[model samples]
Target: MTEPEGSEPAQDLSDQDIFAVLDSDHRALLELADRAATTGGADELAVHCEQLVMLAVRHFVAEEQYLFPLMRQHLPDGDRSVHRLSDAHRHLESELRRLEDVERSPQAVGPILADVRARLVDHVESLSQAFASLRGEIDPAEAQRLGDDVLGVEQLAPTRPRLDHSDSPALNKLVSLVEGYVDRIRDAYTHRGVERDER
Candidate 1:
């Protein structure tokens, strides 16, 4: 796991494995996003938007349900980012609503759509990087096991992404996004699992 140059967390989470998985999903997201961005008409746009939004909604469900609060509890102002991420999710939700309203392949919401995309992308990148910093602080074995415990979110991936992938920065980030989301989700689920098993 790479460390943030400085201002590193006292601990870091295991991200390499998550990044690998998400990188693949990110590719699929990009493919869908690209289609949405370049659609010849609103009908096509709606179809593409549906694909993107559904995937994002499922992803948002897992992240908000499991990850951010854990980080906030552990790191300085780490919890602050949790709210930021949640706010970003709201932005996604609003955009999804807008997409749903496009009855005639509407063309007026480009600027609004663009802003939503920018906010969401920034949220994903920053959170992953923050997690990377935290990853640096923990024991190697702890980190690896932590990663496994949290990986249940992948098993919960809304739908499987295409099996094969090619290179792209956009896709890479998406992959990281998936990995990060699951890592956190798994963490939450793991805690819950332990509680259940104990009971």
Candidate 2:
């Protein structure tokens, strides 16, 4: 996984601590989506929408690679719980893709972003409850390790959502790597989430 320049390692963080990252990111994305929905100017809307989507991409990937699997392994009726959460993620991604397509159209984008925000809120609540349950069951040392892994994987996660993915671990890793590389290249070229003034 690629690390940001001058970044320090995750310092003895527990799984509960890792959930803080998710909470912060969840707030950021919802705030961005809210801005996208309310902003009048198309350019401003596009900027917020792109940022929301990028944040969601990384957050979702980190959870899928680390948090969700832990839930499936540790929580009661874990498989079914994870399936519901994963399906919610897929639906959110689909809505985000639509938001991307109509980014320049304020009327169309507003409703889509609103829907995305609602879905995100619901998903976050569900995941939070699952994690709370898992926290009591999982070992402290293992949770710490998973926390570090979640942070590490997020740095290398794709900045764009990919719909066509398999459940196979090997294939998922390969797809994540390839997509992350391509998305980084595209973001570099287009300055995807960079503010217009900075660009």
Candidate 3:
């Protein structure tokens, strides 16, 4: 599949590593959060907020599909770690959905956005700690293979949060296939409108 427009070129998973992939996503999310927090206009805030949610959803799904399972196999106390991360994922997804609703309403969303930002920061810190704990637990080659698997999963991951379904990998993939197509169509439509407005 072709890389989405505006996405970085697909990296060789063996050479690139999962940490780099996840770090890139985390940076994009932090930047989006900053923009959302600072933007004065509701329309601009909404756009940044939407992008943040999409990226977060994709990142979490990729970890669930590939990273956590590998951790379960390699890390000590892996089950507890995966459970903690999964809980955080669910909470974040719920918050994103709430933010979406608030965005659509006439109500002010500054406080909600702030709360989301705080949660995201905490989540990233916890994830970093988990990764650090995994150092020397698995071979570098095995880690690279797992990272490659995650990259493949990410290519087909949903760009929208899916809070309604159970967290099964198989189910997530099926739902993502449908949601990813819809997201692409919506993005294309929005881009065309922007181009028309720019003319």
Candidate 4:
């Protein structure tokens, strides 16, 4: 399958299927989690957690926007799996938010970060398997197209969680647009997700 005309190639992510793209993101997140765990200072740990949270917000939005809906339509047990995974996503978001809020106190944040890491590990594994099954059920070209879409949307996705937003596609898209804009502003002012070099 060919990429859309005039769309910039997505680094090494071009031509990957949705599963591959998400797996790449999952690896990055897990590595960041490990780094955050090893950090000596509370402030450094807080920065790492902020970065993790921002990455996760992009990752989850990509999944909800493309992955879950595809699962529901393609996999035999997809509907049930989506429901369970959706719940898990909410729980993971809450854990990340807690980690973000308490990062100033490393003692308090350590356990939370650990929980987030564990949950993320399981979540990524589940998605990998589910999407593998899904990939088998769908066309290769369509899968690549969805992967390209995920990469595209993530560029405009929110940098923070909006716990109040529902999972419906149309509504979620609208919310994401607004939240993405607001989050960009907030991240700019607070430097929530900007790396030290960028700030």
Which candidate gets the maximum TM-score versus the true structure?
A: 4
Per-residue C-alpha lDDT of model 4 across residues 1-199, encoded as one tens digit per residue = 1122123453488788888888878877887788788778765777778888888888888888899899999888988998898888889888887876673666787798889999998998888778778878888898899889998888788888668757697777788888988888888899875546567
TM-score of each: 0.57, 0.86, 0.79, 0.90
| lDDT of all predictions | 0.51, 0.74, 0.70, 0.80
* CA deviation > 4 Å runs, candidate 1: 1-16, 22-31, 104-106, 138-199
Q: What does the lDDT come to for candidate 1?
A: 0.51
lDDT tens digits by residue: candidate 1, 18-117: 3333333344454555556766765456555655655565455444443453466566777677767666666667766665565535455465456656
After superposition, candidate 2 runs with Cα above 4 Å error: 1-16
Per residue, candidate 3 scores C-alpha lDDT tens digits across 55-156 of 788788888877787678777788888888888888888888887777442256677777778888987887786677665676777767766766776666
- The CA lDDT at 129 in model 4 is 76
lDDT value, candidate 2, whole model? 0.74
Candidate ordering by lDDT (highest first): 4, 2, 3, 1
Which residue pairs clash in candidate 4?
none
Residue 167, model 2: Cα distance from true site in angstroms:
1.9
What would the per-residue lDDT of candidate 2 be over residues 6-85, giving only the tens digit for each residue? 23443333344556556656766766676777778777778778888888888888777777677777877888987787
For candidate 3, what is the lDDT?
0.70
How many residue pairs clash in all the candidates, one count each?
A: 14, 0, 0, 0
